[model samples]
Target: MPPTLKKSDFHYDLPPELIAQAPLPERSASRLLVVPPAPAAFDDRGVRDLPALLQPGDLLVFNDTRVIPARLFGRKATGGRVEILIERLLGSHEAKAQLGVSKSPRPGTRVVLDAGGEFEVLGREGEFYLLRLLGEEPLEKLLLRAGRLPLPPYIQREAGADDAERYQTVYAKQVGAVAAPTAGLHFDEALLDALRARGVEFGHITLHVGAGTFQPVRAETVEEHRMHSEWLNVGAELVEQVRRTRARGGRVVAVGTTVVRALESAVRDGELQPFAGETRIFIFPGYRIRSIDALITNFHLPESTLLMLVSAFAGRERILAAYRHAVAQRYRFFSYGDAMLLFPGRES
Candidate 1:
């Protein structure tokens, strides 16, 4: 990590209009910016050009976590409206959530859902409030029946019918994520098939992306900030695949930051191992990245932890230069935005 990391060091200006409000007609139709490790003009390309950028034997590790419809609308005992975003399910009928009510409710206060069931506030858990369902109905199933897709805050619009499908990756399997792994969103079934046919290998890890991913780093100094923990699973299969790739001299190309975090966290003890647990591993500039040889990610918000992670993988100046190019080219930004394929810079 950098000896003196400032929150402002990762800042970059982006035009509001470039923030994509919706997905492209075809998932692979979007653009991809190939950023090489050394300083040079980035290759402006399309998402479909992936085959040309990556070679055979290289393993593309993707986060297979699915985005759940976690947003719910309801009201308080006083009939005041409240919006709930389930951050994590504690159990069948219990969850930790963020309340959107004007006034915070005290413990034991009941909230009735407009969609269906009712829940009483159990207490506070950091920025979240613990809620236990009044009835025994499984909270996860109820969320599927009642919750709305919680879109990113920057989208500036309600999630439409199309968003229900477009906001998720075609390969999404394990359902738990609150936000879509935007980089994975670029690979539709056809593109995945193309990559596989081109001799590219695939591996999957689960890192259920939380709403906290959108939260800004409020700390003046980056090291003072703490990351929100998210559940992840790096199964034995992926571990073996990574080992095989390394032995075969193939690159381990992480498809998203979540995948990078999960893989990097798994190798915390200096070597990759199967891991399944919550991780708050924060990667910033000056951190030696030994997990992945390359990364495929989306354009992130300025000063965001995601941006910092990429800056750590590539050089801070290199990443900022790429972002400036992305902006000047009017490339889309955020979850529904365009993608980038980055090669690693020298580790400090």
Candidate 2:
């Protein structure tokens, strides 16, 4: 019989103090933990060593989805404070968002923004509220003016001035994601230029990371957890890049789990195709990774789907051991923390 997989199998002990509350002053200054397929083997390096670690023709896939200022603070008609976090922008005036308040507002209730505007609660999409901004200005414009950068909850502080740029990746172009792809946060313009000089080809994909990424796994078994849907775009150009890279015997190194999901989602019927749609692909151990040969990603929460993904790529035991090493050695954890470079197992 196959080994039973439970959520507890992935749990690890993490101290609250280890969660990184702020980003390093230099984007590329974070440490890199290289975890190869060989069990119990890892090398402590720096993010600046990336170009050296990769082969010349390897394709580095990056997520270019820009993080919008998604967190909005406002008040209800009854003077109750409400925080609205955009889940997905519906149009220029409409968005689906998760609302936080003492009491849930009924339909048609107006929410007054601290930035001198209001949005009407139209209805609901599961737990999210369907909201329509009551203004002539576009939704993007309002968010820029009124919305705050939605840092991860573990950051333990309000968004500060530095967060405007520090929280975003240098290569971000497509403005849609609510959360920054944390792994890409380590790459500065200099690092990208260095990678290019080393002949590491680049490919772009867009996966607007949703706020639900931070949600805890409540299910008892790994397979029982449902993934949150996020928008992903894998253009024909990127598809061609992947094909060319493969034809030349080069590797496909994904920058983050978002890129992995986007690329893998594009592959259907045993081939990769251009795709632009929503995906809720939940990756865990016992899963096969067809699109990526390696990954660069930040440390993830224990029992989190992201951790499970890396476990899927490199054996679960090896990954958990690396995490323990990271913790013992005082390596930072979470969004604003250090990163890990993982090579795929032979069977993955």
Candidate 3:
């Protein structure tokens, strides 16, 4: 490993006002910063010009995990307002969630959700509270009608009618993610069609982003940080496609960090394989990547694990320089911000 990267190495100054409070009016209208393979080559483009930028044979991998309405507001039996954000489902009717209220609800305390459905707090599990549903319908179905869209905290607005549709990607199908793959949100049907016309193949893997994604790294040292494990699945068909793409010397372009983790975690002995389970791979500047060749991702928070992952993919210094350029160019930052097309760099 490249001499255990210090957490301080990723630090940068970001203006509070630059953090995107709202998504772009048009998804594809978001800016794109193209970080070339080397420092000598620099080209900046708009997200709409991606089709002309990528080669014909490149395989653009995407995360198809759908964002669920994990945020639910309800009233405690004692008349206090309570907000519940589901973290993950433990069983058919049991789920783990983060509760926000004036006072912590104890076990056996009942809270009435939307449409009069109720949930009883079972107990605490680590940082999350265990909940048991009291109705016959599945939690997924109930949440669809009753819960609100769990927009990122950086977006300083309440969930609106448009957020339910706008926050999600056009390709989102499997329902599990608490957060949308922001990079994929830029691609509309027209862009997909345009990419297909240019011979860019597309495939999907699922990585259900948990609410833990928003948790900031508490460790001062990079090695001291324990990355959160998120569930991922890469099927056999996708594996076969990847192998075929490799055989033809086509580049594998991952759409988001979630797709990168899903692909890399599924590779064994340098060969891609079908995989399903949790992965806590904490990528930093020293880690050698064995799967993805290119990355399409959004601007990330300074000193964040996501930023560390990108720095690991590209050179840390190069990524930092690119970030400086983005800041100077007035590009938006965070989950709903502008994107970068990165070419993986050699490990130092």
Candidate 4:
């Protein structure tokens, strides 16, 4: 393998028009760039072709963490506008988040919520602001009525009615993630049914993707970067399914990088065991994966950790070449863009 690449190695020139503003008219209608083992093996296909892309007995692991409407716009007691992006709920009434405003609101400042409720900025802990929701109604209920979908920065638009459905995966059930697992966004009911009909087994894990996912790395070297910790749960049932799939000589395909992290985080003593905890694993080049045999992910931002993770899964050279192909073909980039099905090697 080549030496660990600098962040600049993953950089590419993407046209502004290719950054997807809205999802494809249909969820499964988006393009799929197949990065085969060799240059001669490429195929540009639609997401509907997923059933034909894989063999029988492949275990598709999905992150079922639902994206909550975590973004909220409100006003302080002084009438200054502020936007709060919830990171995670620390308790029923307390949470941590990133506050965006012209000026940072100091502790004990009251901010009126969009739902007619209010909150107090209790204090700060590191980069997150501690917020205390002040209302008789529960925090989740308040957010359900007033919170905006925290779409990525690249997607320039106000969250509309369609965004509530389009930004989430068809199978998303556990509500925690601030960001959607973009790879799973392409899987509609019809495509999932087709895959299941073609004998693909599916499993579910949870990883509440935090707001830090959108934070860029400022460090020079890969080792200098501090990964954000996210909560993950790999239950006993999913562990057994993975073990059983491997026992039968089947491949375990992660639907997104979140699934890969959750699966790999669960492995203890060379075998995957059930787990429920926080993980700060930063996967870059030279990191050997233990659980995921293949990955399906969207094209990531230039010089971002997500790009590095994909480079680690496949070799850096292969992924860089694939990105060039994707950009040259005018593939949409970022969260709501097209996806790539990556097989690191022939053997699992």
Per-residue alpha-carbon lDDT of candidate 2 for residues 204-318, written as tens digits (9 for 90 to 100): 9999999989988899888889889999999999999999999999999999999999988999997999999999999888888889999999999998999898898987888
Estimate the TM-score of every prediction: 0.98, 0.97, 0.96, 0.96
> How many backbone collisions does model 4 have?
0
Model 1: residue 4 alpha-carbon error in angstroms: 1.0
- Going through the candidates in the order shown, the clash numbers are 0, 0, 0, 0
Find the 10 residues in a row with the least total lDDT in model 2. 339-348
Name the Cα RMSD for model 2: 1.3
Q: Report the lDDT of model 3 for residue 33.
A: 93
| Candidate 3 residue-wise lDDT, 1-348, digit = tens | 247567788988888888988778888988999987674565679988899988888899999999988898899999999999998877667888999999998999999975668999999977789999987978888888788889988788898988888889999998888998889989988889999999999999999998887888888888899888789999998998888888899989999999988988998888899999999988887777779888999988778889999988998889988888888888999877899999977547
Q: For residues 223-319, could you state the per-residue lDDT of candidate 4 as single tens digits?
A: 7899999999999999999989998988899999999888888989999999999999898877888788889999998889898888778777788
Write down the TM-score for model 1. 0.98
What's the distance in Å from true for residue 105, model 2?
1.7
Q: Which ten residues in a row have the lowest lDDT in candidate 3?
A: 35-44
Tell me the TM-score of model 2.
0.97
Cα-based lDDT for every prediction: 0.92, 0.92, 0.88, 0.88
